[model samples]
Target: MNDKNTTQFNHENVKVGEETSPTLLRFFRRKWLGIWQSNPPGMGLFVFGLCIAVIMAIPIVYVIWRSLFAGIDRWQRLLDERIPQLLWNTLSLAGAVTVSTMIIGVSLAWIVIRTDIPGKKAWRWLLAMPLTVPPYVGAVTYIIVFGRSGWARDLWQSTPWLVNALGDYSINIYSFGGVFLVLTMFTYPYVYLIASASLRKMNRNYEEAAYSQGMSTSEVFWKVNLPLLRPAIGAGGILVSLYVLGDFGTIAMLRYVTFTAAIYFQRASFDTASAAVLSLVLILLTVAILWIESKTRRKNKYYQTSNTYRKPLTLKLGKWKPFVLFYVSVVFFVSVILPIGVLVYWSRIGIRMGALDGRFFGFAINSLKVSGFAALLCMLFSMPIIYLKGRYPSLITKVIEKLSYAGYALPGVIVALGFVFIFNNHLPRLYGTFYIVALAFVVRFLPQAMQAGEASLSLISPRIDEAARSLGYPPWKVMLKVILPNMLPGVLAGGALVFVSAIKELPATLMLRPPNFDTLAVRVYFEASESIYHLAAPAALLIVLVSVVPLRYMLKKY
Candidate 1:
């Protein structure tokens, strides 16, 4: 009886252990997961962010899979024939642009930011204002003014005195070299803006210390300041590279055979399978560039100072200031002022002809719709990752951050192509809609939103929320009452940036626009292509004007 009772108790204890084991597991899960979950506010923010990220990522995966797997045999054939050529052409342009933008942008940034250039204040804003002019629009200006049948070329041809003195081949504005020149002009601002911002905010005490140790001024700047600004330069360079890689307007207009151009051709040729495949390959190349940027940036990490200081040390350029001023003037003239003059001249021509009156209202209204929606949607999507990384900050968070950023480096063509593949087959209801294009824009540009929100929220202290808890406020209420007021400005700034970029966007807008719909960007492109140059002017000018606001804001930040 005793033995039997002991056996029965042992068996009962084993069953009890099994049942209690789950209870313990549940308790542990709730405890650990609560770190992420109990902040119902943050979790809600994260879920909101994740939906945006997943939406953004969907096109990329779809494009890759459809292009690669839909017709494996066809992609294989192209892989052997056209892919290599397309890849090389695309990468070569990206590489060349990257190197050129770095050199020009760094020089321009250093001169304007660190030295005592004449008109630094106005020039600073003016220099960055060129970004307001879309590369395609710039290309259009360069073409109509200087092409073989161009007004300038025609005048030069007619002027016998100057024509005899100067050869006809003085300006070949429609060539590979021309594309590079135009791209470098607009793209350098990306680097310049960021580098200049870094330079201004940087404490000059480090350089002063180097000078005090017997280093020359130049040596101190080169050795101390430049090295310190490596991360800044790297960050700026990455932005330039991404722009060059993804830009289709300038390349397409210049007749350059970039991957973006090639993919567009593939899509138009009723060879979407090929387009999808090429887009996948192109995205992979962008991924490689991003990886390189990440590795290079790791070598130099400079964070904002814990304490602020005034009293910037000014090393007199003395003899070089005039030279610097002249150089900057030429760059500013060619890239910024000259382009605006061209557009203004064209706009006046259009107004005098009474051409811009009829569709102006409709076009402007349509532009606002697209730009506003894109900005709102992109911000909505970016909020999750921004909050997650801002609050939780773990390896998982980092992975999610990196994943979300991957779509950013991708060319808009790849993103568009991905959408084209997915929408054409699976979601037939979305096959031809403005929302589809907006979704692509969100995916292609989520990082901009994330960066903005992340910068804004990361500045807020977690203690604010903890303090709210101490006062017995609910997590959601604390967030709504305390954190949101602080975060709103940043989120709006980011969304505004997205709004500006979407307004000026070219290729995706061109490819994905609903039939009969016309945004300013598209209006300018088609009208310009058809050589209704004057008709495209008001739209072009408006694009520049609209884009100017964010460009100014970004210039200040950089």
Candidate 2:
């Protein structure tokens, strides 16, 4: 009887051990393998994402590698002379622009979406229209109107009293104040769009709850709406900050010294090593901004737990309607109307002066060719990256998605510099080709493509993929036939964004284009920089017109 009891006890112990072993194995698998090991399909995506990550990382890696080997002499020189001023200039501008955009964007978005101000719908489009005008283009127009030699100055000179009173006190468009104003005007749209969308989608239950608890409208906004809008505001602020950080054209045109302009000058002087070092520092600043945004975003998760959708009630601006209208009008006038009006005025001048010659046609065609190719490539590459990130949730997918945005934050000049090193050393034959310019566009604007693609793909259900597969349609066919049709709108939107961006891109085209290969942007920059406003006006006008294609799409999407 004792022997039988002991044998039974040992059998029970063995059973218990067997039961716990699988749990331990699963824990280890989850800790180590993550999503890649759990789903069989994930392995393939993991490899694909890894490949794309490596490709996307090459430029950043090249910049870092070059910087490290850029001898101590270059580093010391930069530290002593250039880095200090550049750091102060870059950071101050980025900080000021980020804060200003957030204020303007968030305020305008609230007025449009939440207030029953007259013409709210029209205001939405007008507010967003500024995005179509590149900041540098806006700077050019502002310079034409407000610079020392601008219309305002000329007009003041014509008035004896005004001229005497304001002698030598004309607005200087080449100062820090000018850079801040131009950047803010063009970039606030980023914040406005995001905030408007967030406000539109916000579940009113929270606000209602706050109201029921005896909170006033002001209190409700402060206690509930603003907190919920944090993520959207944070995202928009990141974009604006990154834009300010990476801006070369606007700052250069305005004659402000920042890292981007410094890098361009360094590269022009064949100081590639010092340029790399500056680029590395710029990358660090970008990374820090990204990190802060990530932390802020992660601190709160805003989602509706219920599936009920309801439109928010617009607040009646009974007494404040005129004030609100004036505010909206001022923003639109400064950002869109003035710029386009000035361009149109100067374009007519250019036409009269025969500035639209054969070379002008060449510039237009070159712009179309490079922008078209870049847009196509962006749409093509965005597919797989968006597919993996959308259909599969995994560590690898997240990494690739983040890696793809590196270019969006880094200056175009830095990207051009990286390619300069890469092509010169590895593929000397391809160094001066137009294709290199297209590649630079692809790198700089891929994030826009990815954003559009991911938004479209997220609306699709995975069950559809399974159903197609079960119907004996292979993965490729399912993607090509079923997915492509549904994704066409988003793909086109992405392509349009890339096209607009490429057309307006200044630094990359300036740096990478072959000799005598001028795009509209290049010609505009050259003519405008030389103070030949009439000659630059036509190309700048064309760019703004092309940019309008995506504006309608954005109005609908947001």
Candidate 3:
């Protein structure tokens, strides 16, 4: 009887334990929903972010799928002939440009931000103006000045001494060296902006501490400042590397073949399968670069420890002022003055030749219509993704945020190709529409919009969200009523960035636009490619003018 009673007691104990233990669903609910009692992202937000992620991921998925099923013959052809050479050319050029830009960009930023450079306020704007000129436009300008049959060569040939002494020593702007020079000139601004911001916000106390430890100014910079600046440099370098990797127009114009150019040629020849294989390789290369950047960034986390802050100490150039001034002048001259000056000079000639005719108006309208639509779509889509990421800070939201950036990292050519397959195969009805062009723009430039949205959303306190929730506002309503109105400035800034990027986008537009539908970028590209400089000049100038719209925002941001 006693043994039976003990058995019953143990059975009751086991039952009580099972009742108290947490189930998987219950545990997840407590952790996820318990984040904010007043304002948590609902199930709807998660579903929305997932849907966006899937859409953003389509291009990448399509490329991979096509590449894998490209058949053994196509794969072998690329592997045996094209892939080896393209890989070398792409990596070497990307590495060279990245190193060159980092050196120029970091130095120039330090001089402008940290030194007592004369006319810094003007110099800052001047330095950043190069970003207004697309690398292809810059390449075209350089070619006009330095090509074998260029104005520079014509002038030199006229001088007997120059011709005799420097026989066959003319500048060849179509070679690898020329491509490197032009790209570095335009792309260095990426690094400069990032490094400049880091320098501006950096706590000066570390530098002072280093000085007190018997470090010279140079020593302090090398030991204290540079270590802290690594994250900024890495971020900027990744952007430059990606730009170099994905660049088609600059390299193609200069006649140096990379993966982007190779893929374009393959597709032009109707070798779609081969293009997919090449695109997969390029995507892998880009992924490796992104991985390296993330690893480097994770290894270092720089932040100010105290709230007490002071302005950065200005370094006196002293005897080196003239040299610094000369350096700044030369960079500005090469990057900004030369390109715009060439455009203006040629634009006058084009105007005299009546190149800006009725067709020009059509090109302008096409550009505006497409880019405007893209900007609007980007703003619309960016809100939900960024809002979820910024306000909720959950694993799902973080994954969605990362996936959104995948489109931006990809080359425009790859994105365009993916859309060709997707639209032609899946959505055949929407294949040749202008909306396809707009969608391409959205995919290639959406991250810019998301970045701006997140920045704006981050400044609003969660308390505001709680207040809205207390008043019985749903997540969507709160976003519409409270969050968006407060973040309009950032939203506008993002929209402007998207507009500028879309206006300049070339490869995707070239691939995706309907028959006979030419944007300004396409006009400029075709005219320039056919050596019709006079015709290309007007459109190029207009692009530059439109690009200036975002100059103030960029300046403030950096």
Best candidate, TM-score-wise?
A: 3
Q: Candidate 2: give the clashing pairs.
A: none
Best by lDDT: 3
lDDT of candidate 1 over 242-351, digit per residue (tens):
88878898888777787889889888897887787778777787788878988888866766453765545655679988788888889888887777787888889988
On a 0 to 100 scale, what is the lDDT of residue 112 in model 1? 73
Error of 1 at 513 (Å): 1.7
lDDT tens string, model 2, 1-558? Answer: 999999999999999999899989989878755655554343454566567666666788899999999999989988998899999999999999999999999999999999988888788888899988989889899999998888988788788898677675468899999999999999999999999999998888888888999999999898899988899899999989999998888998999999999999999999899999999999998899888888878878777755776778789999888988888889888898999999999999999999899989999999999999999988978877887777666787788887888777788988899999998899899989999999889888999998888788888888888898789975556666888789888988899899998999999999899998999998888899999999899999999889898787787787
Positional deviation of residue 477's Cα in model 3 after best superposition, in angstroms: 2.4
| Each prediction's TM-score versus the true structure | 0.89, 0.89, 0.92
lDDT of 3 at 153: 84
Please write out the lDDT profile of model 3 over residues 261-361, one tens digit for every residue. Answer: 99888888988889999999999999999998898788898778668887789999999999999999999999999889999999999999999899999
Model 1 poorest 10 in a row by lDDT: 35-44
lDDT of 1 at 146: 76
